[model samples]
Target: MTTLSHSPRHGPTRAVLRLHRVPLWVWTVLVIAGAGGLTWLYALGQEAASYGACGGTGMPECATEMRYWGSEHQSAKLLAWLPCGIAACAGAVLTGRELEHGTATLAWTQSVSPARWLAAKLAVPVVALLGGTTALTLMFRWVWGAGPDGGVNRWNSEYFHAAGSVGPAYVLLGLALGAPAALLTRRTLPAMGLALAGIGLAYHLGDRFRSSLWPASEVRGPWDSALNHVDQLEFGMIMESGERVSGLDCSDQAAPGDLGTCLSDHGAVDFYARIHPTSHYWPIQLVETGIALALAAAAVAAAFWVLRRRLP
Candidate 1:
């Protein structure tokens, strides 16, 4: 006859095991390295081009390319958001996947409490997410090249740095926000759907409030303002995204994006910049990330409180 003794430590140990099962860090490193390598290759090409183009100036063309590429202030949207999307999506599945695979119960039965299990589940990815994102951000910063004054080219691409600093938060917070949604639904697909919807809605609403959790200033374009924007109609007034219309009646053409606002404007279309005063770069990031995390914390707490007795 054999008797099972409760191993208080098993919960954390199992969690660690599960956390290590996935090689997210490896993929993250490879992605960063690949991106940096691509940047280096681009630099080489620019150097060669500059050599060919410059008559008197040695490497003038290369210098120009370096300025453009190295100044992360000007990366493309795709490059910026790809990592973010990856982090968000990967973390998005945290609890939903566990429930989907019927592993949550198994893990819980094996000496782990619901809270510990959930904590571990969320903690691992967030650590990895933030750490990996920070590393990636540094790499992109270095590779994109910096301005001679050690500043960044803020106009190269709209989403580059925006995606960089905030991407990590989005991914991590997105995951935190996802936990309760997944737990409530207990299905990966539905949970993921809810998570995405929540992210969009949260970002939209946050923008309406001009809260830093969602960066409203980074959007808009060089070809706006000439258009009088107004009356952004949202499905939930959650304010995901709005549009710009040329006519005085601000009800014409609208575009699709998260965190945008339509304003009544008729002037030279300069760019989509906030005419109103805004915070400094670092403070904005801090506030935005902090708010997002706070919201996520509330979400996690709500999920736990609601699901505490429901779990077996």
Candidate 2:
């Protein structure tokens, strides 16, 4: 009689890979394409930088071309949304489809337990997404650093997250949110929809409150002073009594020669801006990444709980 081996090492992971090979390949292609595109953009940025300035002997169109390139390159923006796609895939393909078609149930009845099956489903994608996003992040960072300092705003949502740890954190959050959505819906379409909606809300909330994640720097000076380099969060008038009032309240509509007189009338003596300097980039990134990862951990725990509760 032939004896059957009972070791479960890597079995579930291999099964997951076999089942989701299509998505895996698609992800691989996307990462490769993104890296290639960034490389091209980096070369263009270097060319632009070589041309000192618009008025210099360098190409007359350099400034305009660089501006267009910066505006047109959407790779960073797309990478930022990787989490949403991951969430949708996790909900619709990894969990929902299998559960809907009874494939997950059949697997549970075999040597693979429900927990192991779910673990593999989540683990494989986590590793793939983490690695892919990290590579893209590093490449994007390299490209951004190569460009002129003023080429792109470091605090722009897409550039900021894509160039830091927050990118992978967001992707993980998507996967975490997706699995629970699938377990709850048990139907591919509904699961995908729910996961997408959840990730969308998270994205919106994160973007809306991102600047507040860390304390912002304050700059006070004349209204026309050189304060445009930083990401300004709020602008106001500094009152003679040291009170700060909204910039809107102190309008510049006053007569040009009487601007100072008008401001004095409103008790305003100077202009103040609450801003985030370049130094705050990493602090804000770290804080947001921490929050995203915490949410992902909670969602993953919920997924396992739901799976365990539903299983016999």
Candidate 3:
């Protein structure tokens, strides 16, 4: 007698793709739409820049065109927070709904170990997110360069996060945080809320301390002369003894000359501005990305631990 054996049609990763196909399609559409929108915006920016002198006599048309372009850029800024939406979906639909509906248990019973199943759940979405965010980041960077000089600063939070590795890093962080939050909550709505809260907290902390990630360069000179066209972190008075004292309040000075006298009275020898020049952009981005990745690893570990504890 001859015996016939059949191989399984779907592996864990394939199963994940099948189950979450809707979200995958949505992600693809969003990425494609974002790329198209940015391309259009870039062309618009070029047109606006060609207007030699906007808001001038005989140039009323440029004024309207420039305003419309500026508004679009402002709307594009919200793209930086796209990962927050990813976090909520990961929590509510990916892990939480599966567990809540006992689908995870069914998967565990189908010869797939709990760990492998969880790994597939996280890995598939992570790969998708990385690809999507990377494309968006590159497109955003391209569009940003099309803007006129002094139109937008590189350090602007919206541009800063979306234009570099920081954007993808945050997306990974969201995925990491969402998995653990869903596992912990075991309920879709609560898990999603918790995940969003966690992401919001991370964003707050990252933005709050972004400047301090890298040591700022110091420029010291006369109060007015010390300022440079850079992202200034802090301003202080440099005493004759070479000590830096922040919070140099000279509001009492009624005249320009009195400003110097007030500063002198406070033992100020010169004004110093601690700033991050354009060169520091990559350094700051890499450092923040490293920090975010570290946090993500920890959250992933926590998720695995939670899974193990819940398993029989």
Clashing pairs in 1: 50-62, 69-144, 70-144, 70-145, 73-153, 74-156, 204-239, 212-288, 229-263
Candidate 2 has a TM-score of 0.89
lDDT at residue 202 of model 3 (Cα atoms): 85
The per-model lDDT (C-alpha) reads: 0.56, 0.79, 0.79
Q: Which ten residues in a row have the lowest lDDT in candidate 2?
A: 64-73
lDDT of 2 by residue, 40-124 (tens): 8887777667775656434555665556355435777887887457755664568888888988988888878898999998999
TM-score of every model versus the real structure:
0.60, 0.89, 0.87
Off by over 4 Å in 3: 1-10, 53-65, 222-229, 249-267
Question: Per-residue CA lDDT of candidate 3, range 1-312, in tens?
Answer: 988755443478889999889989988898898888888777776777676546664575576466645755664466778755675567456988888888899988998888888888888888888898888788777776765443466787877788889888888888888888889888888888888888778888998999999999877754452244467787778888989988785657756788679778998877777889888989999999999999989999999999999886
Per-residue lDDT of model 1, residues 113-155, tens digit only: 8888788777777776677666666655555442232233332
Top candidate on TM-score is 2
Provide the clash count, candidate 3. 0
Residue pairs with clashing backbones, model 3: none
Look at candidate 3 and tell me the lDDT of residue 36. 85
